[model samples]
Target: MNKRFALLLLVLLPLMACNKQETPAPAATPAAAENAAPAANEPVPADEPAASGETPAPAASAQTPAPEAAPADADAAAAAPPAASGALTPGTDYVEIPNGQPYLPLNGKVEVVEVFGYVCPACAQFQPLVNSWEKKLPANVRFTYVPAAFGGPWITYAKAYYASETLGLVERTHNDLFKAIHIDQTLKGERGQDSVADVAAFYGKYGVDPKQFASTMESFAVNAKLSKAKQWAIRSGLEGTPTIIVNGKYRVLGKTFPDMLRIADALIAQESARPAP
Candidate 1:
């Protein structure tokens, strides 16, 4: 029975996250191709080509569809489990980030940041779970979304995310954007060469002017946030999307989506228990 359980975990692990890789430019090098190899811990191959028009080596594909769930039912699916207890095994469940710090300045609250990209299908799959999970969080915990800028369509959506955020449209459009790309097919995923205008037109349905949305996507402020997000991903040593960082000190590495939240709950408890600085 134990062996069967372990084997089941192996099969499910690859489905829970998207591997991060650089989309090769036209003048790509052999060394660049070598760098695109899947990490030792990641077994899935890259099936979706990046929007750069050059196919990257096999890693996890970003085009996989998330399981279907009605929008209204997502919260019930994400209801928080009872508080986790006992010491969770390090390295196995999660790894500590050396010199890690919150994505934003500490504000007398525990910070939980999810590093995700709109173009990552794995992230889209994890969205419903996290959306509900976050809603039940205590007032003392702050949840922040840091978009991943992995180049190609990733940069496009990252820019769109920041622009929407600047215009205060993210709270209304976040999930719909995911549905548009992954389910509705109204928007394209990382595989498509989506431009700023394409993304802005989608936002137009929500009352924002398309031209205004497009301009905001390229604004200096949005560019700064995009740059900061890239740096945060680099400093976190992020190798995939849908990663959870608790208080910026631990990176959750659970084998399944629910398991990831379970681990994150435990870490949040641990951080909450620490004496105030």
Candidate 2:
């Protein structure tokens, strides 16, 4: 095997070994888009109530008496649409984040953020599908990508992403970087060569100055973005890479790629129906 492909296997094999159970698929939908969920109890940053969309639930002070049950009418039951055929199920398909985080949408659009990582195989696999789905989204749906910054080598990738944005290279390099790492297997995570310095060198070919790239990677501005990203991932109730947060309110979980997009479509419709601001 080529050196790059070999290195990738080395990085991925260990992660596979540590994972004992695959991510539990939500209700069955499609097989193509299935990805293992990040192990439960993975270290999530403590929730900061002050963060947008992260309002903590208020403590209940009292319990009220139970209400009387209303009479069930066969007519009403027949008139109601079946829940099984619906596009989404609250709590099952997606979750409502407490106090919903604030979203920054352009031109009064609803926001959709894909919380993903470059090193993740699932994210890479999901990219083309998401890219196509994104293009077909309504003009009112605003989309952005937030690289996972949970630390270790992934932190380096996140820094690289932000740095590329700083240098105006993201649009050109984002997909290419994924291609390099996953398909081409050229961007291996070998220790000495996978650091920020290494990422700078790789992007250098795209006209980024290595010195400037390294500096930008560590700059306070980039760090601030990273901090916000970390908080968003934490508050979005993100259990793993490839999770989708819609309007800072819902974290979509799907059994298939189409299922995920279907959930997102429904959430977007719901968000679009909300009264302004």
Candidate 1 weakest lDDT stretch, 10 residues: 45-54
Score each candidate by Cα lDDT: 0.72, 0.65
**How much lDDT does candidate 2 score?**
0.65
> Per-residue alpha-carbon lDDT of model 2 for 154-251, expressed as tens digits?
77888889989888998889877877776665676322237677778889989878889999999999999987887666555556557788888888
- Candidate 1 — what's its lDDT? 0.72
RMSD per candidate (Å) reads: 15.4, 12.0
Clashes of 1: 3
Residue-by-residue lDDT tens digits, candidate 1, 77-195: 57845434655767756778898878998678999998887877657656777788899998889999998776667778989999999999999999889888876777776546777
lDDT of 2 at 60: 13
- What stretches of model 1 exceed 4 Å from their correct place? 1-17, 20-84
